[model samples]
Target: MINDKVLAIILGGGQGSRLHPLTEERSKPAVPIAGKYRLVDIPISNCINSNIKRMFVLTQFNSASLNRHIKDTYHFSFFSSAFVDVLAAEQTPENKGWFQGTADAVRQSMHHLLRHEFEYVLILSGDQLYQMDYDLMIKAHIKNKAKISIATIPVNAKDATSFGILKADDKNLVTSFVEKPDTSLLPEWNSDVSNEMKAQGRNYLASMGIYIFNKDLLIDLMSNPDTIDFGKEIIPQSIHEHKTLSYQYEGYWTDIGNIDSFFEANIGLTADIPEFDLYNKSKRIYTRARMLPTTKVSGTTLNKTVIAEGCIISAAKIEQSVIGIRSRIGDESTIINTYMMGSDYYQTLDDVNNSKINIIGIGARCFIKNAILDKNCCIGNDVRINGGNHLEDTETKTYAIKDGIVVIKKGAVIPNGFVL
Candidate 1:
């Protein structure tokens, strides 16, 4: 009954310019992650694992792929009232503009949300990597008789400066909030955190951008159109006016805000014990059920690599990398510290044989390191790409170099002997 009384609104961030090339063709939530799953899958999966089934994902730009992914992947029982829906920005007589900020997105879509009967509204970010049981937060909100609840994570002083920090009382009631406070202001902003977090030097409570609001309060707040963002406006102003609970969550959580963070999150999956555990049976990440074949590899020395389904890898060596679905790596090639997002569909035999310059995947004798090969890329033979700080930030039609990581654009064709 509690699950039925809760509805989720997932905010697919605006523009996503920080993740340029990746967001070039798709929305931030649609961007692929961990070789196989999309960025949206994280939040959606967390919601499902938490028994919060009804959700509406709000995205504006390049949402076709995101829409398709949700349509194809999430299907509950026909009789069940569980469903995942994508709600793109639409123009009406009252509001004709796009989502200006996080709160605005929810405000614009409030009409659609009101159709469903829910007591609490769980607002989540689409670009975060974490596994959380929101039921616990909801229960806490109910127990505290709070009108709003925010998920807070104890972060060190360095990371605290980059987040919306909150100071909570002994009762875990948010006392004050500051958006990205200066480092000098950190000592005064410390909250009561667990001893483990304090031992790790994570004293300040940082807002995780996860919120829970009573439906009535959210409806009342949406009436005020001036407050467009929760962090900058609604939160700081409302904490004094309303009872806001601070639910502390000490777990592996990362915001995929930029290309560097995105790349690091994917590559981190190859670690011996990844912080974001993808193997937890109780907290499984859901995605489309592609009946892909088992990955076939030969003559490749794989070390700390995670390969998805339908891959044909003959690389001489692959270390600390993630090979996605439908990937083909030619023989004698070496791949290191890379995330190759495998192709969407396999190239037919005739198409492969008829191709003159390059194929859908990597060619023979090539070496790629510290790079990301997007979907359906054609990397020709003898191509060498070594991404590091030595390389300057540049963007070509085919690829881009940001923070020293080479990102091959989607469906890019890199000819033979190409070097970066």
Candidate 2:
């Protein structure tokens, strides 16, 4: 029963620097999403839903949290023919180096892959938020007999310069690829238009950085590459010789590369018609689910928010937020548009005005507007931090809330009645 025809390789090796302090302690894939799931959960869950079982997750850049997450969430035992594993970077005798780029990461792992009998390899990124039926793309690839198939979508022509744009034929065959080209040089520009002023219409198709390749072709190209990227090197060079097709996938796909985008993606999931649904029991998304009691909202006004297990919200007003487990919100505090991480002993018992109360754990607070409070923050009572328009005018490093909310560093405590 040698049925490993398709092998999925997820590239989780990069240290996402663009995400700043969020990635300071954990890998980008390990960053919490929607107060419950991690970034890597999207791809792994998609692979499971698509019926592609044999997979490997490549990790680098402080993978302790990510590795623990994978171990806890993905519990599939390997049989004689099927398995899912996480392969961190290792220094072998032949290649004692770190993964340099996207293409280089795959190149480093080719030794193990070549020994297995797989027909196709699906290469993907770990930082995207999307629900895709990759089997459909695979079927399209096999039907077209394409040596390579790239999943792509239409972007605004002006913004296309920021992405890898593909010039595909009517048959979806990729003719040319431009990686983040200067849009100002376009023929659509006029004399009054500065190169930076060129705006593209929403018609250009950009590569989604998701690729399906014939095992042989992928190995051959990776073996000999000058640059260490697929878009920058392999794909651009391969257009001359191979039948590379572009498969357009129109679904919810977002590259959550930065804190703002990451925040937006999580908030987007709570929409009335969300693109991705974690509540879908049939398409169960796997993550490290901690064992905690059900969330309790006693005398709290919660509207259009998601509260995970082990959370105690007593006498608070919460709206449009995602709350994690074991976090305690104090009475009389108003929480809005925020995300919290769950852990035991995040909050301490406090005496507020002759009454016993549980104060907000680290990073817990009343965010009256668009603000992101990172993990493990203890926000004290009588703290009125505004994320509204004029509240961002203040200039303080630790307390002055920027970008709609104050970001309290992990393990920091805000004393009671503290106003920033």
Candidate 3:
């Protein structure tokens, strides 16, 4: 908590169009990550671990799933004053539009949040996957007596151009800020990699979009109606006047904005030495605790996989993948490099006699390679889903498939031995 007040506003209103089919029916934050968790869970879990109880999720586009998930999972009724709530965009007399950007989302919710008595208000993006001890950041904020603190992380010269790069002085005061700078017009800062670095300086801090705002300053800035976003306007505009501090973070943090990044983050878990360890005992990542039984891997030979609770794996081979709770795999099925969601639905697969065809959901025998299977999909036995032999192409029509992997939407059924 900055300045003795503790209230956090999570900006989760984005449509997440980049995620395409996954975000077709749900908000970006509600989209499933690593099969067992949603994107929004990361930030909320971080807040709970930080000991910050009061959180408000501000969303607008496709919030049904997100709202429902929040209701079913986060229910802390013990604390009357501190709670977690979802605030949607409502038409007011003064404002007649949806949230235009990050700052706009907070400005829209100012009616309720600004009236409350809080010292510091934290604004975080719900789409990133990382483990942070916000209490440490808050303590540093109080010690420095800073008006605002932006969490920054160092990136290579090539990556710095794609992000909102920040420049801080020796005293940790922000000196320069630019969003997605051109590589050709960057200056070399490090001597060793000056020639190798085509972009700006070799060492630069990129904004994580995580902020700790003094409540008064946040309210005053939002009231002005001139500032648009913290990175694009507010922070840079007030860098000289306000004591804006840059908090450096050297940990695992992925924005997971596009499909490539999302897929890469999930597959990273299977690494022998993963950068982000979910099993860290000191900093527990909290999520909706499921009461399902432990996953049972039968005679299947599995390697580099994260299987959640209540999963019953029969005779099958799973490699470099993540399986959600209560999901059952039939006999002689091969699941290769794919993520499957969990469900309690059970069906008989003893008669299943297919190895080359990879299956997704219960009793489905599917033989898939480098494909993303949606939840609750039923694949038939002997159904070869080889969209392509090449790994680069995402679409495959050899077996009448549109994409490299056959995307069976939620609750879809594939007949027995049906290809594509």
Clashes of each: 0, 9, 10
110-159, model 2: which lDDT tens digit per residue? 88777778899999888998888888889899999999999987766566
List the candidate numbers ranked by lDDT, top first: 1, 3, 2
Q: Write the per-residue lDDT of candidate 1 for residues 254-362, one digit (tens) a residue.
A: 9999989999999999999999999999899999999999999999999999999999989999999999999999999999999999999987788778856358999
Off by over 4 Å in 3: 1-4, 188-202, 344-365, 386-408, 415-420
Model with the higher TM-score, candidate 1 or 3 = 1
Alpha-carbon local distance difference test for all models? 0.94, 0.73, 0.74
Off by over 4 Å in 1: none
> In model 2, which regions exceed 4 Å deviation?
1-3, 78-80, 185-201, 344-368, 388-405
Q: How close is candidate 1 to the true structure, as a TM-score?
A: 0.99
Q: Judged by lDDT against the true structure, how good is candidate 2? A: 0.73
Give residue 395's error in model 3 in angstroms.
Answer: 7.9
Instruction: List RMSD in Å for every model shown.
Output: 0.8, 5.1, 4.6
**C-alpha positional error of residue 31 in candidate 1 after TM-score superposition, expressed in Å:** 0.6
Q: lDDT tens digits, residues 1-420, model 3?
A: 342378988888578876766676788888777767888888888888888888999899889888888888887767456677888888999889888888988998998896678899989998888999888888878788999998987777777777887777776767777777778744632112223332534476788999998888887889877676777888778777888888877788888787667767887888888887887876666666677777787788989987878787873688988777667777677877767766534444642345554344645355755555566666565555553445343432211222344344555556677654
